[model samples]
Target chain A: MADEQTTLPPDDPVRFYQVGSFAVGNRLQPLDLRTVQAAQDRPNALTCGHRACQGCGEALGARYALDAAVRATDGRLVSVNATGCLEVFSTPFPETSWRIAWLHSLFGNAPAVATGMAAGLRALGKSDVRVVAQGGDGGTVDIGFGCLSGMFERNDDVLYICYDNEAYMNTGVQRSGATPPAARTQTTQAVGPEPGNVFGQGKDVPRIAMAHEIPYVATATVADLHDLEGKVNTAMGIRGARYLHILVPCPLGWGSASKDTIAVARAATQCGLFPVFEARDGEVVASTPIRRLTPVDDYLRMQKRFAHLFAPARRDDVIDRLQAMADRNIRRYGLLEEAAR
Target chain B: MPVQIEGSQAVARAVAACRPGVICAYPISPQTHIVEGLSALVKSGELPGCEFVNVESEFAAMSTAIGASAVGARAYTATASQGLLFMVEAVYNASGLGLPIVMTVANRAIGAPINIWNDHSDTMSQRDSGWLQLYAETNQEAADLHVQAFRIAEQISLPVMVCMDGFILTHAMEVVEVPTPEQVARFLPPFHPRQVVDPDDPVSIGAMVGPEAFTEVRYLAHHRQMEALEVIPRVADEFREVFGRDSGGLVRPYRCDDAETVVIALGSVLGTLKDVVDERRARGERIGVLGITSFRPFPRDQVRDVLWNASRFISLEKAFSVGIGGIVSSQVRASLIGHPITNSTVVAGLGGRPITKASLHAMLDRSARDELEYLEFLDLDRALVQREIARTRVGTRSGPAAENMLRDLGAVRSTPH
Candidate 1:
């Protein structure tokens, strides 16, 4: 997905302008401030040339967060991934675009495997290094939820990152526990009276993580690379069982154009559906406020999965339920920026 | 260290001695005492520096252990019967990820009738979960094998499940010569995580592999398991040198060489069978017992080589595959298909029924008559069950299908017992 950009320096200068806008990035402003991903000289942790569909928010979120993590640690990280779309599309056999030390764990046990790694490192007296376990929504929200909670409850010395792509895209666009209500997936058909995923079902994993009273817990969207990177950097600063759940929209799974990954992810947050927030010691300590409130329908109308919601007759009830759900999230997390009025 | 201990406590001591960094488990019948001992150990600071996670359910137990192991910890957990089945998904993931986390499985039967008791059905059901499965014939062995299980699992980078007979081994107490931490440390080195999460050299793990490479991945897991055969022996030899006990490493045989009839089985039932064999030996019957300690690696060659010369082999197992036969019976038949001996299978002691030495002796004696084929149901009490069912079915025409079938056969002459 890379094109030769023979322009100024490879690093995006926009990061510099945006650095002072947040408390997180400002901490690293004096330290050369090179966007690790933009530095062509450095390794692309999630390297280029892999079949992650266009506008694949998971891919973008993973890359930006990992690159920033690479930059944060000065190149001393090993990652254990759980089986899912991110794993399927990124590394197809012997060919891997990953330029980091990586191991693939089963679909439901990335946190457990990462715990082993952390323990192993401690045993070896390698205290300088840290671990980050990652998986897709299917692996994290459903299959690996118990494991994730266990890690938090015990305060394990590892960070778990769940790339929340609403459905199991690699497995033919099936519904994952992270899929929003009224969103159509291969498994959760759009033909039913309720149409799409039931509103009450599925997990609010980040809130669940918060309930564990963990050292750190945060949620971000791939739409904001700087914010995503900042969360990763912040998680790295903590030493216990930390969680960073990123809202990564899958273009293929959501049935949207590849270029709309960032847009969709951003829309998810702006519409007050997927709140961008962080929790510490079981409290919502910080949240990226929504600058402008967009209608939940605006976000849904863009994706084919939500196409049924806007059918010939238009099922406004389904849209209203979705909006209510988003509204609930907004009310719970206080997503609206104070001065947005 | 010496202490008054039940089989579960002994196993717990062994786990503590092994110095697992994380212990995640749930309470299950027969297996509860073991985790209770562990929880006590953790709370009392007897087993310090380990994360003791008391999870909500068996599923959570396994899942928690998985997370603990994933983040570079010597992880451990335990379960039995239905609890094992409940955590089936996480159990598979544990081994598939090649995490060297040790787990103790108290063997018990899966239920439809809701009976909570001893049986091999639980451990046998997960025979192919890719974890190295080890069976213990006694509480001492159960305690000791867990130490070796952790070392062997980490050495081979494969998960290991140490199976002990539910209630039989887990509930019974015996004086176990527990190893000191100093000795266990020498035997089992601290787990060195081969793959870990690091923020510095940011990497991704557990990446999804598609159908194109899934087969090869399984193939590699199989290869690693095969590698365990060699690794186990080395670890066992080292264990013996350090602890001064011959664990028999893979399989334990009981005087099978000169015997005409050999009773092959696993778990604590072998102790009873051994006594039965001794009694039969005094009666001029040349019979012996073969206790299989390792089930996953199957110990195929060792099994064949050990019992190859026996004129007849009676494979005794505690679990059945419903419409089929005994789980171990089928495995024995498959392993001894081309062997020199005639193998007979016995399905016995299901749902924690007492497996008496008399019945075991009778089973071996019956097998010696050559009336039993490759598979036989032992101590079934089928006549009594049939009579009881017939008596109940008399006035109940609306009974279940099986019961209805019995009713349909109305006055067919009851067989003389």
Candidate 2:
């Protein structure tokens, strides 16, 4: 088996085990090669015992990303958070789950705050300490967009992470700029001629960050722990402004089962609804290929947000349009492996 | 050594001497020259170890300062009327978080007619924002107050806003004794933040304080301001010993002793008020001018003590509460709850109309005769206002009041819409 694996090409897709590269940890892999989440001494930047809902993807994604960041910087990290679900849940007045230096300034100023943190640290002659700003989709793509763009434009030494949960979950699942088309949010009610969010709305913040020609920009999902951790590690390794957009499925917002958060996020990427890729200086450097192709219906049917499209009658017209979106992403990002294609 | 310099440049030099670690700049009228001066200093390497950020907006400028100050950097920023209104949220946040940031407010009128002129409306609008406000009466005071502002802010862990009239002070050139860096360093110690974002010691700074402890947090903020009532005068005294200048205090009582009536005011208007008082005193009128330097933590006791012998006092306000009479007079009334003192509110210099000696003399003469209205507008055009009111009553569509008034004054060509 070892000899056969050795003979395989570097880009070969075939693997001996069922889990293959999908598993976070493998006995055959070296300790350094294992994912940061699977490590024994991984810094639990967002430690347990917080007010996050069961199977909360933002909590999980933040832990994976921030832990990796802390590791990359050798435990020297200060995070500035915009007011959102992550901030509201993690630090409730006198209690906090954060293990690293964390700051929650306002709903729309995290990026600028992080920029100031970096500048402050540099001015204080503490160049080794790094800054990481974080916020939910509502905070990042909507209210915090200008500050984020400004931070990127200035090439500030800070890493900004956006945990895209599609809607404003903390505010009871209101439609946000990161909400997908035709998704049922509180603001985008499921009772209209064209039920749920309208098409041709919302923003693609990762692409916007890339447009700044920043040093680094990447998109990840909570389902891919290794990829998310690796992306954060890569981001922390760079100096200038870095953006990481991680798709964190909100079980409450999406009306998916608590245990299905990871599966839902998996379906999002595998179905090509969200293209996981990395870019450098306005150019795509790499993209994660889909291990298994999943249909858009399989992804949509799992969430009650999209249940309106399936029930009352299957709106195949809307479903087909969503499928087209997935196909476009698949083609654009080259998300399918050659063998799978 | 006193050198002839613009007020903004003098302030910028004083601020630089304090050695702020970070200075965020977002250009707005009047406040622009102050930040521009600092930016030049940063560029020239005269201000070493300072990160001068040219931010996108006033909101970002204040936000950046909040972050910088939270991370143990002595942060500074400047803004004006509309700019101050824009960053009002972060202004409250900085004070609530107890970050000792020093800001220069180039006082300008808040506008619907969009006038970029000097007034007390900007800082007056943020009176309850938990920031200690010090109004500068002169270019020299504007420069010296900044040095005292940083010390007072850091000592109490509350933000301080040093307010100077926008174009009147910011654009006006005068002989200002900008303190040396050595003098500033001696007065203002290295920033030792009460709470900071440190890797070795991690603590959440701005948290989601619910109703359980929210009131306590706010009460503590108010408590800190009350504490500042003592710190302000003490720091001013310390500054006097170190810098050899009495630049800032709760109130500067000019010729108030044994006076029957005191003219109370804030900002550069006090300079004119002082001149008016002197002229009136020369005419055998027992009148005095009390300049309020520390407007916030309102200096209630000192104001009451100074006005103890006085029978009446007039609050000459540049900004009033629109529907209500006076912003500062209300506080003055509150201070003299049962002191048998007659209080009046004189709203003057709305949208930067000149508060000249002639207008002051006329207003004071009326006050001395006890014929002035309880709430009066100094030099207001009553005929123009009556005409506009009559026109609005006659026609449903009276056009915009500002436009009609401007046309009446022949400031702009009247085009029928």
Candidate 3:
């Protein structure tokens, strides 16, 4: 149960003993080294019997992040949620899947609400209680951005976790500020000359959070449960505004197989479309190198939203543009081994 | 102690005495000084254990108060005019969630013409938003209402909006009996939330209620406001006992007994109407004034009782329904539905236009003689309105009406560049 063993060192030889280093749990590793989800008695902050879609990455991501936060705060944690799939699915009046103290304020303002909860708790001499605000990409990157940035500028004691499922999945897959380029959404149709979401737009919220020079800012994905849980834990340890932009793939919105949620998220990171990295005070301290460099097509072909680019005369030009974006990310974050780079 | 202080400062001191745990605010005209005072008190350690948050916008201020109140903290915030409109979505959310957060809306005119002056348009816009709207007639009532607002809000578990006229009350220096902490403590008990975000007994505070339960949930909110109709007066009575002054209640009837024509108004406009009524009464005109402190939970029964025997009544409104004319008068008319009371709506003091004694004397003389229109715009520029109406009829595009009116009045250049 030592603190050192809780984090799997980069050079640990035991990483290769089982499925892989990216696996959530390893039987060969000790209890402390395993992910919180691997534990039998995890808090299950976003508990069972919710109405999320099959293989919903946001549901898993919320559970992993909040359970880890609960473990870090010793069960003294409060969650403030924005009106999104997470808030709607988890609590549907007279019933709720959330076991921890939770609140769903509005479509936006979770960050400010969490800031208030922290302040209120502190004022009441209950500083031991910690706060976490969460929302989807639509909430965090677009509608709630002002409040989130304000929380960051004030450095309020709250950890805001964004479960980024790319688009506004709750509103039936409309385009959001976090929606990737050339992705077919409800608003961004696939029949036009552009065929999907336009290029040269969409927010990079993790980078935006880093620009705030906060105490902690990290990009995580549901593909790596240990990484996501670890990031939440690290954010919980900090006393100021900490942001965790977790890339949670949506099976319903992505038009992918329900079972390929983790696989698609893994392909996103492995192809460098979504960078997994950590920053402190606006400086990149570490990044998870892609173990096997994959093409952006491997990530795109799994989802029907991008199926337009593959069929009816292959849009090699758009695919190449996407690959270029991934390459740019790889170069920017150094998300590859020396030979691959 | 009774001291001559600005209305906002007195309210801040009264709020500090009540011991709010969180005070979130965004700077807006009129309401800015209230939060500024609270911020100083918090920073200087005068108000210990209080967190003063300078939010980015009015939305964040209200949202933060929602969070603080949900977590069982005594929360407070203030806004006015467009700032109130900006935070309006959260305003409804706070009340819908039944968070007992007290907010001060320094009542001002909502803009298109863009005026920063005193009016009730802002608070009237939120008359149905489920917050208990308490209008103050003077600096003393404005300060005293804060102490009672907290108690009443906590008692019924609904948000309270303590509204005072923008610059007329918020900026005016007047004698206010600011209560002591001991008096506030005796009157307003420590917050014991009906619902709280406590880890020991974890519960979801704001859940998504579907069609099956949404109506019931809203009805419950309405039921709580009805409950406030009782709690407001009880708390105001308690405040009187503790602070030794009459402050907040549903309505304050001034010389209504044996009166024929009763004048009705809200906020600081009531002070002017009361003075005008006193002068008329001195001349043996048998006039009376009724000041409505609570706009929401509308005090229907009380209003009906006061105006029941009166032959006629005049509703002097600072805000009206624009197209429909008379926001408060409409409610007053609704309350006196069966009664055969002749009523008139006098829209006055709009956008900081001074309601001088001369104008009131003319208007009241007309009202007493039954020579007033059903919907009268007191002190309106008839020529300017006529010119604009004529221009609109002649041309398809009249530019903007506000700009045109300003130009016609020589408030701006007559020629467009």
Candidate 4:
């Protein structure tokens, strides 16, 4: 089964490109491909002082995703927020971090609500305005999954984005349907013989979305701003159900350094733990290839949720099992496209 | 023109006449026929320009209505007991967000053992959800209420629940003088949303109102609901003038001029209660009927003004508040607080059991003697209840309480054919 080799970054100096100079709006660059974040007048859909935990990957992901959506729609966008970290942290009852026409409904109903908003807009002949529904992992994969599937099946004209940080970060880091195996969560404690979360428990919502045969289904990470932004732009170009899943690293829940948030997300993709890909109508269109593959331990070692395997005595079997999962994804999706071939 | 039709179909036509642009619903009995009729009309091109959405669940149906209503499209949906309960969260949301969505609630009983029969328990459980609840006394009234629901909801920017007795009114075929489409158009004006989703003048709807303003927002809803008591009769007059029918109003009274007793109730049971009152009046008794059309705003002042002279009133209703006796009776009693009418509740026709005229007469007779209990189950099997009680006393599980009673009495299910 192990026909392919996992290669770490070479010992020699490697090539580097202008990766994130355009992290903010590249005012110095041409307007055609400029990021909304670079534009001085860009709509900061999420403004300041969100109560998101320090180095919150969710907050970063939301801003990137929504800012791009706003730009794509030419500032004519309405967002429905499912109840989670984004809803609670941004809106503590009276205050809100949103600067756009926003609605915060109960958890798991954002997709349905957004579907309604889209239908309402079309009925009113305001089809030019777009709608976006966003939620955290717990809301997306667990509570709101049915509404999401319904939206896709109906081909509702709305984009549903899921910010996946593994567990229910909003409710004190309990395990959600998106939680990775062997990850320690409040509900999936690292105490029993199995240690952390039992193997093969969580749902593969991206695959589920693909199976629904929606117009677009994409997986991205907070570390890849360009890829995330491009997918959002592509989604806005289509006028049917679209799903965007972005894996974000929670500093508090993962027990990682706030400064290492982006690094953690990068390691997740580079180690083939969360294979980044895009599909259309249930068919794989393209995927971000792993430039330099690393072992699963390289990604897990940074997060405290997986620290138990390395503590006291090394749990090589647990590491091997987890590596097999990552390798399986790599092979199934052909994540190392040309390199594997 | 007067035509005999299934009450569900009649209400469907009535709702369609209101010219809702978007119709979304998930079928649940006895609410199924309404949506079925709507879908047929939609398919036949009779409902042109209407978008009929077959949603996956009651939650999606209400959510679709919310979306349509939020975007300024006139929206309507229908559901019953479990469906209503399924969409309960969105029900509160529709009202809280101030969306003018109209939904037909074919009132049925909620269940632990799972019953789908007629009862006010469904709508009763949602009385505090901040939507204006209107119960119909007959098929004609139920049909007419749908036309008015849109007008009142749109005018006040609030959702309305037009409840009719499940099966009793939803499935029963009856004579109803449904107004012509043009007449309904004139009576119920086009839905002009007070708030809309527009990029030109965008405004945040369904905002997260915190403690600082949550109480004030709820207070506004309460005040607006209270305003319906006045607006209800006003619209009813307009509806009568345009449609030439005496159907809907906050409260309707019959033969109460020289009455010493009044039998009050909601929904179709009110018609049977009125019949019993008429028979008593024929003989030498002085009794009247007060049909509470608007059970939500409660129509406290209007009811007090109508039944002011009655010495005693008995509420023979299809729904009760479990530990609290009655849902509508408490409101009736509170309305006549300063007045001198004695109050009694007779919980009847639970889970689709028939509320016969003879039972009403017996209850009225007891009320006249000043010997009626505060709360009574109209035709409860005493032996079965006693047996269950005895079983519990002996530390044994009273298994399938209702079925045990039915078997003990050698009785099967009952449905009004």
Which parts of model 2 have CA positions greater than 4 angstroms off?
A: A1-21, A337-341, B413-417
lDDT of 4 by residue, B109-149 (tens): 88865788998889999999999999998999999998988
* TM-score for each of the candidates: 0.84, 0.97, 0.97, 0.94
DockQ of each: 0.31, 0.80, 0.86, 0.44
| C-alpha positional error of residue B358 in candidate 3 after TM-score superposition, expressed in Å | 1.1
lDDT of 1 by residue, B1-417 (tens): 556679998999889888877787688887999889989998999876776766667776776566556656788899988998988987887787777878899888786645567888888889989988999987778888999998888888889999998888898878788777888978887777775544444445555567888999999998988888788778888988998887737778888888888788898888888888888888888878888888888777777777777777778888767787767656666777766667777888887778898777676666767778677777765765676677676786544544444455575223321
Please provide, for model 3 over B45-82, each residue's C-alpha lDDT reduced to its tens digit, 9 standing for 90 to 100.
99989999999999999999999998999999999999
Model 3 chain A worst lDDT window (10 residues): A1-10
- lDDT tens per residue, model 2, A220-289: 9988888798899899999999999999999999999999999999999999999999999988889989
Looking at model 4, residue B371 earns an lDDT score of: 88
Candidate 2: what's its TM-score on chain B? 0.98
Better of 1 and 3 by lDDT: 3
Candidate 2 per-residue C-alpha lDDT over B256-291 given as tens digits, one digit per residue, 9 for 90 to 100: 998999999998888888888888899999999899
lDDT of 3 by residue, A1-341 (tens): 34334455866655453464457345545665578877778899988999999899999999999999999899999889999999989988788999999999999899999989999999899999999999999999999999999999999999999999989999999999988898999999899778999997569989989899999999999888888888888888889999999999998989999998989999999999999999999998889999889999999999999999999879999999999999999999998865432
**Could you tell me how far off, in angstroms, the CA of residue B78 lies in candidate 1 after the best superposition?**
2.6
